[model samples]
Target: MEFRILGPVQVYDECTGVLIVPSGAKQRALLGALVVKAGQVVPAERLVDELWGQCPPTNAANALQAHVARLRRLLPCGEPGSGRPHHEWLVTRPLGYALRLGDADTDAGRFRRLAAHGRELARDDPGAAAGVLRQALALWQGPALQGSGQGTICAAEAALLEENRLVALETLYDASLLAGHCHEVTGELEELVVAHPLRERFYELLMTALHRCGRQAEALGTYDRARRRLAHDLGIEPGPALRSRMESVLRRQDPAGAAEGAARAVAGPATGTGPVDEARTADDAVAGAVSVRMLGEELARLRGHVDRLTREHRELAGRLDRLTSSPVAGPRDLAS
Candidate 1:
């Protein structure tokens, strides 16, 4: 049996496809709350406060009891005892409700544990942390309840999950850069920046990628774009880290930095544009500037190719016209 509470509260039995959701919003809320705090007994008072929140009715306990009864019916059972009344799945106590996935599993609980592990790995080994985070993030199928609509508990948990996902992406990109995968990381940063136009970090990674790829002008342009976005949206200049990166690119960049996977290297191309054959990549801010720089480089490369093609076309057209006017199917009498 699988209990999913992230998007919606769902119980699926392998024998059965999709189990019916416990009726009533309050009942669902109760179940979701328990799932988010799975294995830990939530105090009854906390559940009541969350459910009612200073506006409970005169018979709130009576309503709670009815909701609990419905939830008990929805839960999966092991073996039923014949003689007396049985309460195997959900147990009522003075404190509150406790859910045990034990043999079964809950998405919300797994998500929380994975998120915690990801953070831990991030602090210890960022590269490993990125891997863990990817696993954790993949668990999210869709919006909480798949947009089935959630009460306070599910909404809060969903938001937390989304925030963790963003953090994971950021961390993963950072780890890739450190692992010397700037070429691979650039595309991802561009997509992320496009998705979150106002986010400066994605631009930061783009700048780094551009610099690493030996694109000084494009890297600088990325910084300019980021500055513009920050100023236009937030009414502020680019932060300290971004400003420093821009300055580094302004000065002479070192190609060795590129070869060494230097964090803030603005480097040179393979054709050797400078003495050191070097370039600098943006590194300071949000740590995702390489992606921005790669985007600029791609645009510039395209523009240069277009200009070259246009010039060649013009030259060829002039030579063709001269040949039509002068020579007549002859190459200096075959130059024999």
Candidate 2:
């Protein structure tokens, strides 16, 4: 069986090829809550609070039980000869109910697994990572837990799922760029920047794509737009990574005189025996100074890149820690 919560609360029987859908909104919400907390017993009282919020019926427990019974009927049965009851999927514990998905798969689970795999591949084979991430993203049919209403647990889980989806998208673009598909992803990155204007990383990637495609002017323009958006929205400047990208673009457009001076500086003073030799020596010193300054600037840019990457790595690690930790209080704990 496949219990999918990436888009909607749905269960599909792989053996019979039949889809089992809940009959009502509350029922769907119940399934969503259980699926998100599958393998754990959710206290009856917590379930009541999730189902009806502060407006639960006087006999809320009875109502919850009734709903659970009806939902069980709609679920798929176990393997034909296993002698397992269909209701075994929805087990009744001493505390409350638990959705025991022994061998079933959930789309959300598959997405997370594939996304992790893709991220691992990103460090080695970005092209392959892009393909895996695309497959992970394709699993989403629509907004997560759609039709599950706005119950607290469902709402929180849905938001987390949506966040995971966006992160996957960012990784996908990153992989695409690393695979040297900058020209192809430029348009998509532009759309992403417009859609998520606050995401500075998208702007950074877009700038790089444009610059690599020889659209230096457009890249600078993108930087300007990103700077404006950051200032207007958050009363701040672009982050280090974005600023570094703009600096790179500017450096790329430096006049040929700069390169010629650096070259001359490396070639050193010409051997001669006249006033011209002295003048050339002085010129070489000035050019050599310019070369040193340019080297310092390049070193600073590289440092900024390192700092930005370190910050991003820390941030991603923190997010991963939060995601792996228990997201919510246990049902018994919630009741207390």
Worst 10 residues of 1 by lDDT: 277-286
The clash count for each model shown is 31, 0
Candidate 2 lDDT tens digits, 173-195:
88998999998999999998998
**Model 2: lDDT of residue 266:** 66
Highest TM-score model number = 2
Cα RMSD, each candidate? 18.9, 13.8
lDDT of 2: 0.83
Candidate 1's error at 271, in angstroms?
20
Write down the TM-score for model 2: 0.73
